[model samples]
Target chain A: MAHADMDTQRLDLPEPMPQPRFQAGFITPYAFIFPALLVMLGGLLYPVFMAMYLSLYDWQIGLDLEDAPFVGLTNFSRMLTDPQVWEVLWVTMRFGFWTITIEMTLGVALALLLEKPIRGASVFRTIFILPLMVSPVVVGLIWRYLFDARVGWINYYLGAWFGIEPQIWLGDAQLAFFAIVFTDIWQWTPFIFIIVIAGLQALPSEVVEASTIDGANWWQQVFLVKLPMIKSILVIALLMRLIDVFRGMEVMLIMTGGGPGRSTELLSLHIYNRAFETQQLGYASAISVLLIVIVFAISTLILTMANPMKSRSDV
Target chain B: MTGLFKKGVGALAALTMSTTLAFANPYEKYEGTTIVVSWPALSHFIKAEELIEEFTEETGIEVEVDALQYLKLRDRQLLEMSKDEGEYDVVSWVVMWKGEYVSKGLLTPLSQFYTNGSLVDPNYDINDIADAYLQNGGIVGGHKGYMPGKSGAMYGVPFGAETSILAYRKDIFEEQGLEVPETYDELRDVMAKLHAAGIPALTSRGKTGHQVTAGWLLHLAPLGGKIFDDNWNPVINSPEAVEAAQVMREVVKTGPAGIPTFGFGEAAAAFLQGEAAMHLDTLKIAAMSRDPKLSKIDGKVGYALHPVGSRCGSETGGFAAGIPANSQNKEAAFLFLQYITSKAGDQRMVELGGDPVRISTLQNNTEGFDEYPVVAEQLPCADPDWRPLIPEWNELNIDVLGQALTQVITTDDPIQPIMDAANEKARAIMEREGYYVWQ
Candidate 1:
């Protein structure tokens, strides 16, 4: 009778709910993620892989894909040896250095100054981001017109306000480079400002109070407590801005066309001119691969050094 | 019995209608077939768009026009041709694109249409087009693909024909006591005088790439500089080329402050605003410079032949229309091409302040032609091959020569090294394209 009772209890236990099959659970998670994974593979990975494959061939614009001759590593080696590539890369580096340095400095300084809840701060913030909202192409066109020696409003304003002579803003190599950099600063500084301001506002109030209780001054509180707390955000912003500098070409394309002797020809613009203007699709693809590797390396190095999420766990 | 009789009558009427439809118009078979025509957004294209309705009404074929920027048009045409079938039946291209288009087999040879009497209108006289314009634009590699007349297969018909000309401010020149310069030396003297007199002189395209190169070629070609020699050796760094560069430098120095960055539009704007004393550009600008609505210096501008250097002519540059080889509606496209470039079309173009490639239209001696006589005179002297007529010429002219010219104008660098470097680069490009014989 006891054995019969034990069997009845086992039957009443509902078969342990079928053990919640591991395979089904595992597949459910993946099935939920499958569509996005497919999108990533199609949009990003496929193009990257295709570009890599194209880098091995000597392809011209008008030729059929099959007709393009396979010339493995020739384009890569040629790019490495090419002086124009070095020049363009140097220009890109210099542009990135100047633009990023100015933007970060101005951005962080503005963020620190305007972090307090002041009257009309929202209006000022809106005004600051106006340039950011304008299209890059439109920005380029606007700057081009303003920099025109004969008819530009910039020259007119300078002459009228400062009693300065009209300047050739986009003619000389140096001036054209300066013009593009200035335009970039005007357009991108607000992006950093908005990011850094958000970071500043999100700082823990307790940490700030503790710093204040320890007799930390305004500079000390900002440099030591506030900045360190938001180091990850700054690093991420820097990384994004760096990527932008490498990727940007439209503004320069419209303004200078990498001209006055390629003084403003960024690496990306050089790749574009090589592919479309010169019809060296294979070589351009190879250059693009090199660009991607450079960007990837820089990004990985930044993430490793800063690790934005690392501070979250520590806090 | 009455139903049978009525059915027979209906059948006979249907047969008669079908016969009438077959013999109605040459393009009747292609009726209701919509064809897309792509060209750059220029005045002539606008004129074509205005007249496209007439074409549709006459043939019952539908036409859609896509007016894009010059570079965009080229890219679109190239992308379409690279496919098995193209979206554009009629493709309008710059004269410089002829060699590339032919070499890539992007254009259909129009000889078949010419031979087929029913396809072409009897009144569409190919001989009406100027010989220089016809040869420079229509014929490529001994094949005529577009316009009828002359040898080779017609690949394209001349749409808006243009050659470089010297446009000077008559009022400014008169006030400054300057005559139209005939030689490079005289041009320099005139520019110097104008500069000393506190007047800007000689606005030309100085922006790098095709703009600067086209401007430079105006001087380079007349200075007896050849882009290449008989064996395809680049002679762009020759003494004449250096002289041409020097001349360009002197001229640019006397012009606007941002001369190195000035494109065709900017240069023209400066001259038309009466700020510059002289402008060297296409003949099409002559009309624009005289237009009361656009130009501030209307009636103050005078046209002349481009200043003579070692030679006495100007570089030819213009747009042409061709039927794409991959066009699904080649017959309809050809009809459109012929209709636009015909005598009536050319007349319409001229009336709309656009340049005409037809000799009869140009010689009309009417109000438009009377206003700009230099175009007709300069047409005879236009150098068809002012730039190299090769598939690689765009890179050589714009990327190589354009860069070299930019350096020449912008820097104090010795012109010879720049020219030599450009030549070397051009030669390398040619060799890569199998233009040179390998030992």
Candidate 2:
């Protein structure tokens, strides 16, 4: 057998046989993905398209869609000059900035603190994620109760523990804005904490150990090695929250109803008020188109930063 | 023998006719038909729901009620009525929304049903319902800004009518030697004294949107403020309106610490929980004030008519029931409406914590009337045209005036500029809605 193998190796091998370009039916791949594509079209694209379509008409509530007068681009042009729209857009941006900044910072710090197995760590982790489990509407109510100017636990403790005067947390515009921001942080930090901690725990221990052996300090290890490795996860979490900031309005709607001169009125809540409160369905749809574009641009910009096709080692 | 037979046959025929007429059932034709009613989830509606089984048994018609939040009912009704096949057989008509609904041809004129002897109960006297509530709930095509005018058509039946009244802590008033204020000046003085004494004086809704406007509009008519003049020009910044605004500011400033953020719930809580001295709002709050389970100062609460400003005027409007034009079960729906608004039905509602729009029911139901005698007294003062019931009112009252009222209550910004800006905005809305087409 050895002699035969040596003889065969000495001879040149024939050129490889040509392979067929197609192995299966052309429709098979598309068939596999048809359901998902259909879902995206139905669930995501359809509503957006409908909003754009509705934006072209001068529609009021109780009017048939077919009977609605077509005032092409008028609704869009009106929204451009609507002060309320601009005010609420600015409010949403400010809200997004404060909430995302604090939530990311606090969430990462908490995840890092509890990623290791420590005494009562599980209990603390459980308690931290409890706020995430609560419904957003319920969270709004709970926080509204806490922030009540009179007979609230927050005021009571602030006075009892310190000698501070009670304040109407939801009355003043600035204070109301701050109150909504604080509530968002309390409810959402846990979400970020859960995601970040999962990412942290899943990290390869060998690289961390190597960093430790190379005499890198704890802060250096976190900043240079650990955080850099989880940058993609952090960006994704942030993008999710940023989109949420644009989309969510239940908390603000319940807490302030965009009160004290529209100070706490987020963009989504403003859209709601425009549509239902004012019965300007067409104008509201136009504003909603603006929201979709803003969210799309934000998501695109953030996704580019993450480079999902590349691995951490490639970075 | 022939004469005796003829007399006997005539006698038998007359006897059978009289018996059949006496025992006729008005609800027989609608039996087995099911209707869907969209109503607000208020206290009275919940209680009225318990009596629906009896209605079903008597008529053999099924009722499927969708009890939604009071504010949400309109949105639901609007969408439902817009559809080719309406989801609700009977929809609630908030008084302010009647203009839009009637003008848009969404509701059936109930006069058609009332004129049908076979459909309407003979004993169901529409006149028994209080004129103020009936006019506000039923009439349409009246002069602009006026609800009941020279002539109109009936479109709905008032099921849950209400008016603004004052609820005060009797214990506190007696202790402070405060008399029941009968005028705006007296009320302001009383509130100031109560505030100066370190007590939360007045509790009223100040949250933005319909709530704030509803609270402030209570003073608008009494203070001689009109949203528009005869020429359809915006008059919200008139001197009387400015005074009303001032009165509103004082009420909020001197009230509980969280008054600026108070909705109906918070305002009612402030009074019911013994945190405030007085509350001037819906009669439902007064009714709830007497419930021991709900109110901390239940027995100690006293009710009074709203104080007079320029002239006596109180906020009057509430839920009414009407069949949508597209409703599939219109006959059944109309029968259900007539049944629930009959004298017996109104009395049952009054017994079950509901306000009555019927004069006979209000007079007859004296068993638990001592707690809220102001309900009767305030009826005459509740001007049906208190707020303009135009299609543009929703935007003007809620988005424009509501925000202005919030600004007034929350900030020290000069009231004149805020009100003038509100007036300008109102003018813009009115003009856009074609109110000033002549101009």
Candidate 3:
């Protein structure tokens, strides 16, 4: 009886049920989509599958793929066993953690602090988001030049004011990692800040008023009311940052070239070196497959944490 | 609201897809079609574009040249080629990609083009190109895989190749009354004198890993040492190599501040800007001297063989180009390949402030720079093949030389400790990489 009722309701809807909105292409629906879909299938899907296939072979970039003897699971096994891969992964995770944590906390806190319509607040907000607007590569180059041991502005100030020796920002292993993290935070915190402000602006005001009515103090209102309401938006901001962290090779590659030792090598940079510089295509592909898996798992975890019921409305 | 959010995400991804797929057809009646030629971001390529109008007039192919530094360019080209898109018909590359690309059937084998005599001018002889330059930039593996086209074959083409030559300020030598140092002892003597004069003799080492590593190896090579032996075994700890290291460590006392973090750009800049009086660099800088825009030294540059430590030799480094085997327009690619690497192209490049590898271009009596003394004097012995012709050299470089050279300049650590660490690490890398290890 329930099913029949649902079917009757469906029939009562608009004629042809709006022709299945966003349908795949050809003739009835835009035929242009067919060409576009085929392109995606060929360009995106094929590379993905080929990457998986290549992971089974001992492939080199300049060597014949046919000559690459198939060694199923060995490439994956090698990647798993390699200490350097793990080292890079751990460094990347730590990097991601530090940047994301600092950016998110400071970003959200600053957004909340600046939400008041104070004098010159608009100017401060504009300037805060400006860093986000600059291209990441340009930001990297600017920072790299500023941090140069000999000619950098940072060292100049440090030397002139503090009587400190000019530090090798990108030449020391630990320093390079910190330098990249610092650069990333400097450029990207604004992204988190802007998103948080937007989230704050759209939030309903009645809840805060109601919390006040319940005798909640400022901290109480923020912790017990506003934060819960914005929890979902926070997840979205986290998702974007996590993705950027995984794939941001440009700044790191340009700034440090994954050097002073492999100390600053993020997974993406490592994959780049393996695929091109070292010419180990199969190994790089395998590494990327694992990366995709890791990213997917993390996203899933974050999504689940954000939405307990897996409900779309939570985000 | 839910539908809107999903649509927005879908639309953004779709937008990214459309742009990437939107490669302009090069043969589109010579109108809006744009062909992207990927290359190293070195100013040399940009310098050549000043003459691109001539190419456009002759061929009617609208060109949009894009460049990135070579390492990133290599990464981008590899990733892009693996997709098998016909987006770029021509891309700048080094010889390393030839073996892999040819075997994977991703690079065009230039043999057929040469056999037919249709792609290249018939007057071009196979021997016109120096054998050393061709071998260094030729096919990587023991396969007839890819040709860079201009050197009488077409899988790829030479893009203004030049060997690494030691560079120093002529005025420095004259002021100090030092003859251009050719041997290690002479270089040491010069360094000792400069140290006594307190002008910071050697350019900083360990600035950028590759920059420091590259020059240092060339410095060490003339000492009759190499990072690896013929079997790809790591033998950098040879007595000659150690002696080379010891001298480098001592010479580095005269290195500039922050020596650990300097790159070729800084090192060369220091030399050219008259900050560092002596620098071992490349012959391509010869173009820099005569050009008013690039020259920091006005009539103050002098050149010689990279100082010989034990006298094996200096190294060669330059750019090469390859046509993907799976390119949709193979014939068009070959034609562009030949055009770019042709004697005319090379000569024009030199005219446009580029370094030329071809003797014919160097010997071009018509060009204005031929009157410059360095151009005439240095062209004869500018041989390449100083860097070994091995596909594995790139790895050997990053693992072996890249690591050690950084240490050689940074710490006051003994040369023996650093060389030992490098040798041990290098051997394991070679063995693990499936090379013939000297047990």
Candidate 4:
């Protein structure tokens, strides 16, 4: 009887007033986002615009900016034929290819193998990511010392264990390239591993369990179901790593200084040397513009193909 | 409220007047002002910092030293000067940058400062500085703009002077019954003997760009190889240069296994650790080699003039401190420069493992001079233009010439072709910079 009386009182109450619609005017949403927009404009767009403008001028170090002569598109035209630019680009591609491939393969394999909760898993994870925590310059210095022919532990151990002669790891072109690649793998593979492991742990237990019960082995389940399910995550991780390759240069700069003959110079480092070392600020800016376009185009292609947002929508 | 405000204003005025009265001297006028100095992380800078307290105590001024890597310091100065921010009151510059800095009007002319009796110390004898360092490093474009001596405006004061010298193990030379090498051919023979005696013969800088280029210039200049002739034509591919290149390649075979990648630090380490019998490098390393804490051959190292090829001289390179034109405290900065490069300051620097620019310091019959007598002996034989004084020299020498040297050392390719290609590129760069009008 009490429940009936409460229901009658609720029905007798006036129908709830219609909820107010969000009155987002044209300026209100922008007002809320103005701070973020301002930050992006200052930090990102301003530099891009400045680089584009500077690329058109023939400026050099120690000269006042106003004294710089305006040369329309000459820097770009020169860059088109610059053999050094092409050589560095080729090196960047080759380095990225080897490092990314090895990192992805090793990262994913390790993640799968260690996906199960095991003793000391946290400790192993900490050790794996320690390289990523180190400063790039410090990493370069450590590796430089390690690769020293006269005093390096690497040469010492190699000689002691395998009876191999001491090698000049940074002096030779092929070896220097290998050294930088191996260093990148050491530092970044853990990033991929961490990401893949997160994705693996987040997988629905019911589907994986059902796959296991359906007579699918571990490798089969990972390849046919689990990996396919986390395809978008893999794509995002790959794109982020690809961007890192173009942006990264401090390690190479400190280790090889882009050379035993431009052997280890990435495009970014070449731009730096041109600007500071050669004092060709305008030419460096022109090269920087090229680097930006290349990176932007590649990023756009990856995002368009993978379309992580589309995958979310499908889910 | 008005009575209190009147009392406050009166007290402030009285305090200001008393402060002004206390600092009546011109040098003390800049009292309480703090000046910033940007310099390379060299031992000289440490010595300067240690002695700066004396300046502060005398003038009632304070100084902050920003020690940075050599390259970083150069870039910072360029950036700061270009922006006209007055971030650095004093800038320490390499000799190679004198032409560039002066041409850009980045450094102030010190003639007026020298004339100002209050700013210039009476006992700070400008003539006491070595003539070679004064003329080559302190003066630019015939302007005695830095450490002026009866000539054009002085632009900088020579603080550290380095001339290339040959350092070898004295015991090893005696054991092999060899005298100091007097010529390139003799050097080759000595090296051969050392190698056969089962000792690493020589170590030199082979890292690409500046290190290799600087090392090669030490060889090239003494061999009569010129970067350009009077006609401004690139002549780095000359037969003399090729011979120097060949000698460099041959010499490395007897050096440490990674001589091709060795920089000055590595080469110096190899020599100081007694792993190599000889090292051809700047005299600055000679100072370090004599430090017992840092060297295994501290007492056994012998210094000699660089081996002569077709010519009989060595390359001179070092750092100098200059007042940037954009500095707000130009007078105070000039005082600081004079203090550090002064006779007493240079002696103190010598004691602290820095190369000396003062003749008195070099001539002093002290233990420091006795240990490195060859430094003073070689100063007279330094070739000022061995590295050239053009603004574009760093680029041409490192990118073109150094790149060529790197290729020759790293690969089995013939030296002539690589040198010719480098010359072609160098000529193009020079032409583009409007440095040459003749084809």
On lDDT, the candidate that comes out on top is 2
Best by TM-score: 2
lDDT (Cα, tens digit) per residue for candidate 2, span B76-100 = 8988898889888998878888888
Clashes of 1: 12
Fnat for each model: 0.82, 0.85, 0.31, 0.64
The clash count of every prediction, one per candidate, is 12, 0, 23, 9
lDDT of 3 by residue, A39-61 (tens): 99999789889889989998875
Which residue runs of candidate 1 sit more than 4 Å off their true CA positions? A1-20, A23-25, B1-30, B143-152
Provide DockQ values for all models, in the order shown.
Answer: 0.61, 0.70, 0.18, 0.46
Tens digits of per-residue lDDT, candidate 3, B333-401, equal 666666666777777777677766566666664335532344334434433434444556666677567
Q: How many steric clashes does model 2 contain?
A: 0
Please give, for residues A258-310, the per-residue lDDT of candidate 1 as tens digits.
98888999999999998988788999999999999999999999898888889
**Order of quality (lDDT):** 2, 1, 4, 3
Candidate 1 residue B107 Cα shift, in angstroms, is 1.1
Tell me how candidate 1 scores on lDDT: 0.85
Q: Which pairs of residues collide in candidate 4?
A: B144-B152, B144-B153, B144-B154, B145-B153, B145-B154, B145-B155, B146-B154, B146-B155, B146-B156
lDDT of 1 by residue, B149-186 (tens): 35456688888877888888888888777889988888
